[model samples]
Target: MAVTVSPSRPHDTITGTPETGSQLTRIALIGNPNSGKTSLFNQLTGLNQKVGNFPGVTVDRKSGFAQLSSTRRAEIVDLPGTYSLYPKSLDEKVITDLLYDRGSAGYPDFVVVTVDASNLRRSLLLFSQLADLELPAILALNMTDVAERHGISIDIQALEQELGVPIVPMNARKGIGVAALKIVMAERLATHPVRFWEPNDELLPLVRQIRYYFNLHNDYLALHYAQQYRSISFLSVDDRQHIAELVAQSGFDATAWQAAETIARYQRINEVLLEAVTVTRTEKREPISNRIDKVLTHRVGGYAIFLGILFLLFQTIFAWAQYPMDLIDQGISALSELIQSSFAGPLVRLLTEGVLAGLGGVLIFIPQIALLFAFLAVLEETGYMARVTFLMDKLMRPFGLSGKSVVPLISGLACAVPAIMGARTIESWKDRMITIFVTPLMSCSARIPVYTVLVALVVPDRAVWGFLNLRGVALMGLYLLGVVAALGSAWVLKTLLKARERSYFIMEFPVYKWPRWKNVGITIWQKVSAFVWQAGKVIVAISILLWVLASYGPGQRQDAAEARVRAAAPAVATAVPDTTASQELERRVASVRLENSYAGLFGRGIEPVIRPLGFDWKIGIALLTSFAAREVFVGTISTIYSVGQDADLGTVQEKLRAEKDADGQLFFTPARAFSLLVFYVFAMQCMSTLAVTYRETKSWKWPLGQLVYMTGLAYVAALVVFQVLK
Candidate 1:
């Protein structure tokens, strides 16, 4: 096959000048899943990437800026991977909508369709479809090295001629052909206007009528507009109605036309593959991945291995993060002390107790958060996460959940907001809803700080088997408790909410490979940074508000209480040394001010309600404040203790350890600590989570029901634990 080289028309009329007037060229990278598309994108864009959601959807949108040449820069968007333009799932629909709707924000001027060299026929189906759309596209035959290893050879020139597009053979992972890929992208962006596919004779009149009606660019695009007019958001309601009427009048059956188009595209793909590709082997031995899967996916062994990995992950997170966490704590404390000594009065108090303290509370968990993201990224990059989902399907089905539900449930450990969003992929509504409802029962990162503090107090630091640290084991137990609670609650919900439709689980497992360290690092950076920024904004605002509320009272009550404490100071000085007496006087003054403050009044008001769970007034305050977000429990405790700005978790723990009730008994005994842990495990304490749930469900009824049920379960469970242990 011989091809002609033609100068394709530029997207806009500007020649030798930057497109979009200083705006970088917008190029979209799209391909089938596991086709090395993301690897190519990562290589091209490096660290200049940002992740967000597409308009009106929860699916992730990843884009990055790449400098293609000295004078040429491009913004590349990595759309969700899909097998075809025809939509089956929400993610696939997103890709189709973006490609079909030219007015959409993510519409690209040029497309780089990544094709897996090892699977030419299957990968090129999407390429052919894009070609049919009359869009200028570059074919990136990625994973050439893998194809070569598998004894597959491609005639690049012949394939390019057959497909009528620029073909670039490159290994994206090793960066072997990245420079050539960039050169092709820049050239194609400047000039590419060849339409490879032509409409069939039978559909010509329908296509022409639609093209004339809508002023479409070509016949293929018009055909798509006719077939998918309902889903095409760019078209108005009246336009869609008119198009529908026109299609009816022309005898265009969408399903039959789609089927005929698919078959014709496949026949063309097979011809192209046969002409340009060669396979040396007639038969192949089983791959290493299959051999490994036999053992890892075994019913009993898989569960045990999964549990062992889970334990080790938690153990590593707790054991390795301790040193860095301590350092961060000490550094924040030192900074707070410097601020306190450098300033004076209410300004000092607000900065130290309000801003710095709140920041310290959230920043202290950075080490754990980074480690968690790193592990999860590694698992995903290695393709082990897919296997985990497959392994979990059998276990999850009985609880009215799909294997897909495992994703959201596991993601809940990081945070529930996105986890609930992740549940949208589950095709079954009942399974999706149940997954969302019970996901919050899983212990999230917000609850980790609280668990660590309380576990340090009650659980011993000794080892269980010389290799397993006792505290690590205890942490694993807490995580397991959460998993058990989530599954058990899912079971109960399954009974209450009848499934309207049966759901089947289908997933493709990518071949296992060594994790790309660069991608893993990027994932970790993105997740940790997002967590800090998102949570930090809320924490800082609430901290300042809380400080004011805790600092002031209804009237002169705060003034009168401070006067009483100061009046007794001199008499106390007669008995004790002057420095000790002054220090005690300062402590007494702080305590009096806190007790007479509005926060104190509120805590006391709620004391009787939480008293059954062995919570004191101070804990009552933390509980109320934590309803906004669970992690605020630590910040609230730190504020209420009136500890120095230079206080660490150890300082707060010591303060709580020494705290006594009216009967002079320790406040945080084993029973109380366990009760508090149990309460947090089951409580619907995060307003943000509830808000997300409401948004996902599109109704207040579900979120309201969740709050009542989860909170009631927490109260009853905590009450029982405290009553039995106290």
Candidate 2:
């Protein structure tokens, strides 16, 4: 392949850095969607990457720290991928605004342009746009292995000459050419000056004019030209209509200049390809992607497949997780008992019954939730997610959501926090808002404990189809009910907030590829760690507070109760025996302390109204305590019921079943448990979620509305469920 090399400048000088970057080498990775930009970034940054949101926006951001060599550690930031410099979505705006707004946190010292190997023409359009920006960049031809396997080869030397930047051919997926890329980077960092060149051709005048108008007196003319070309300028000719017309009559063939610029850029690219790239014609093999897609994407068959996939997920959580949950539960109780036996003080009770038990409750679900994500990541990476989205699009549109909304909805089965965050990918403002509103309805992992206890009490564990268990399916149905309610609510919101509607959806159907294990591992690590950090603290604090309130009472409460118990002791040498009378006295003493204590008073205050629906003062206390998290109901009720009995140990369901009301009738019957289940289904019982909602929406208003509306609905539903069932 022949090449054109502009004679090397005898000596090039390095440019001055921005004030803050005096001690750090800052590099940014930029490219169009599906250009292997993220893969390339993962290669460079590896395990050092971090995912965070941009300040004051919901857009996802990723940054990582890496060492370029033994002595140089550089900071790499991966900007959102965009087609052109023009901003369309809020996400694209993130990149464009940050680049132009020099006041941004860490502006890049260098940019890396990644191009897909198969689609060179479309890829070059963006490359040419970036080149005119005059930023120091290295254009890497990613996915070269795919191209080479297709008997295609790109001329690297010629492309480097034509684009005025180094061209590194590499397969990011295999780690090939990574070291070669590092060598080029090191050379650029050491010998070559950070260089941004003005295009040596006809497009220079328009670049100058646009610079004069939009940014008159600006110094970086070349970079500005590239920015405008990539930004909205190219999309609508009318955007630059006046300037374009004015330049037309000025007799410089302005339109021709821009056209010639486009033509020559491609011309040189083709000539470079003709010189360097060689195509050895070979018979293409049968694609496995289509073969697998046949059954997975069929309309009727696909629906069956999706259900099967969902069934497998639930079965694993419901059936397989029981063993670990039991072990974790036993471990928590054992640790608590050991602490209680070791010491004799309020501090021992606080540590054992409060913090340790509370933390265990939250962490116990980690295994099942992590498995759910692992399966989802595998499905998503294999490219079936797009098909799922396509199939669900029509069904979801009525609910004001897109197929993309399903990601968050499915993720909600694990936790609602990340599920809501995942909604950021939905493009339309209306659709995204709807997805966020309804995600919590999808029976999160937090609800599992409550559901397990209620289901065990109310529903029989029976079998159906071979390998299909009724209890597992019932759990799945509860999840599905939440989904149905969420979609129904969204339908109402869509009608209420009817702003505008259109069905134009633009999305990239990336080629089906195996799920990257590293990406999945990173996701699980981040989500699980953050979940523990955020919810663990709140639960622990609340548990400790409840322990204090329940353990000790004021004035004569403990004294009176202890004296009554002592009075019940059988007659010894010096004591009078009053067995039956003393037993009755002790019971009466306990009732008085429980009535006057803070939790007791609060419970009694709410008891009159709830008593009609079959809840005792103890149940009232559990309900109030559980507002921190809905699933806390099981543990709260378990503790309250256990407090009433002589036995110090038993499972939550056993305690709930044995609990009886003053009428001597069995409490927590099928009817009462069903009511409790309904209450949990719709309750606003998560403070962390409210905080996230306020943070996302930027006001206290929506979170307040959410609490009132959801809780009111839950109460009404609970009342109805109990009355009807009874």
- Give TM per candidate: 0.81, 0.77
Clashing pairs in 2: 1-275, 85-230, 85-231, 86-230, 86-231, 86-232
How far residue 388's Cα lies from its native spot in candidate 2, in Å, is: 2.6
Clashes of each: 1, 6
Where does model 1 exceed 4 Å of error?
1-17, 189-214, 222-257, 400-437, 444-481, 488-504, 568-570, 573-585, 604-617, 627-677, 686-726
Off by over 4 Å in 2: 1-14, 17-22, 187-287, 317-333, 411-433, 444-480, 495-504, 534-597, 608-616, 642-674, 687-706, 722-726
* Model 1, backbone clash pairs (residues 3+ apart or across chains), number: 1
How good is model 2 by TM-score? 0.77
Model 2 residue 17 lDDT?
A: 46
lDDT of 1 at 349: 89
User: Model 1 over residues 276-305: C-alpha lDDT tens digits?
Assistant: 998876437888889899888889998788
